[model samples]
Target: MKTHIVFGESGGSSLRLALKDHQTNENIVVVVDDLMWGPIGNILLETVQEERIKWWEQVLNEEDKSDSIAYLRNTYKRLSDWTIALTGNESFLFWVGDSPTEYTGLMFLLANIPKSIPVSIIMVFPAYYKRYGRFKPLSAGEIIPEKSSILLKMQNPFLHGLEKDT
Candidate 1:
């Protein structure tokens, strides 16, 4: 099955639904951190990760944001372990939107994902018109459920002929 790595829970939920609609039984992994605005020093290191979490906590507290940043700990570990355990039979598709957080997540995965596994990316861009209000998607998660199956049609070049029917 294809392991889809997407940013945040909303994206994960939406993608999950889309995959179901297309009769695809792919797995969805969500990385909840908004890595766009925080410390990047030794980000993969355990200590540095703790420090980064602290920084996020401080920022949230200062801004009176009620959401807790503690989820980062589990999410980081889960993502790390998942990627490291990937086998050659599995494939991946990273959904990227025109946003810093999405780019950051994409870069992180690209840097660590093993070369043995087939990898692909889905780039989401905004389409807009000034003359009249037209339909546009800000992110992959924002895609309407009924139309989301279109994203699944994207081909993974690395697995064009290697795909197995499971």
Candidate 2:
């Protein structure tokens, strides 16, 4: 199975949703850090429950069993194999009140990724304005550049989802 690691500020969730099904049965590991002084989302953990109420409502409405929850847990467990076993270390990570440059955990985790499997990295930021800004997606052959490669940037669907609010 190929491995894809996307890390950046402002568009982590958008990255996940875009890459999740890139390859069938591919394992996806998404880690979000606090974006206030650091990376992306700035909501407080204490208030995240209330803030995420709408998200939870959608989740509950979309998924109908504990197994759905279990699937995520199992997928995450597999991520450790690459980080711990391969890298031989771990650290306490705090996303809340941190800056994107401060964590740098993704760099460590990514260093351990086996080269045998295909891999790619994406860095996103808000371009233009919040309402319409997007992290342009890289086209096939562009993500992993080689001879005769053509790189193209595509629109992010998560940003498209935000169109509803606009």
Candidate 3:
């Protein structure tokens, strides 16, 4: 069966809600990480883990440090396992938004995803240009699978560079 994986910030709850609302036939996997504004190093396994631990330590309170660390480790483990399982599967979609964190996640996926697996990326624009001339930035929680059709389609970053060809 095809699987639809949604990568975003906010601990995956919003994506899961959105996917549940959309009622898709495909199995869904949500990878949530708020990497938008943080210190990120090379995407190597060790570097990524060290950077994440450092970042979490700085952001989380001393009392919550242990719990937060455990959560981060578990989340990363789940994401890694899911990525591995999805390889060679013909059907998969990566739903990402236009943000530093989301973009980083996209790059990571592109680097690791199997070349044989055809992955479609739906890039959600940060803001909507209203007809009345107001630009409204969308909240990360606002994106839902039901509204995915309106999102921009970009060439797979693995095959094509991150630049948008005009």
Candidate 4:
């Protein structure tokens, strides 16, 4: 089975709809917390996890879910477990956009998962944006859900000694 890992919830949701349209049984894992903004050290450790939760609650200006939801608080732990539980038969297709959050999430996934597991990435970007003779970066949310099927054909190799499952 191939699991699709995405950074934000919107990106994950869009990719899920795309996968449904493409008629695939791929599972989606949405990393809600923005790793780019938070202090990431040892997420598996309970003490660090508490510090991050407190950071989110007190530092970030958002409604606190640490005290309200049990499952939500252990987001990193769940991701870590998911990564550890991946079998040799399972593959990963990371839907990465041009965002720091995606980059961090991808790094986390790469670090945790075994090197034997095959990997692929869908790099989303704006088609028409031109900035200083360079294409502007885009997030997965910017990708058209209808074009996901076609985009699958354009998946790029996440090369770092990683290759797609043959």
Q: Best candidate per TM-score, number?
A: 1
* Residue 161 in candidate 4, Cα distance off native in Å: 5.6
Model 2, 33-106: lDDT tens per residue? 21222222222222332343334335554544355434433433444444444332222111111224423544
RMSD of each: 5.8, 14.0, 5.0, 4.8
**lDDT, candidate 1, 70-102, per-residue tens:** 467787687667655666688888777778889
lDDT of 3 by residue, 65-104 (tens): 9887887777677766665565464555666655666677
TM-score of 3: 0.62
User: What stretches of model 4 exceed 4 Å from their correct place?
Assistant: 42-50, 61-71, 74-81, 126-137, 157-166
- What's the TM-score of every candidate structure? 0.75, 0.30, 0.62, 0.73
- Scanning candidate 4 in windows of ten residues, the lowest lDDT window is 126-135
Worst 10 residues of 1 by lDDT: 124-133
lDDT of 4: 0.67
Off by over 4 Å in 3: 9-11, 35-51, 58-60, 126-140, 144-166
The Cα local distance difference test for each model comes to 0.68, 0.32, 0.56, 0.67
Give the runs in model 1 whose Cα sits over 4 Å from its true position.
41-48, 62-67, 126-133, 159-166
Sorting all predicted structures by lDDT, with the top scorer first, yields 1, 4, 3, 2
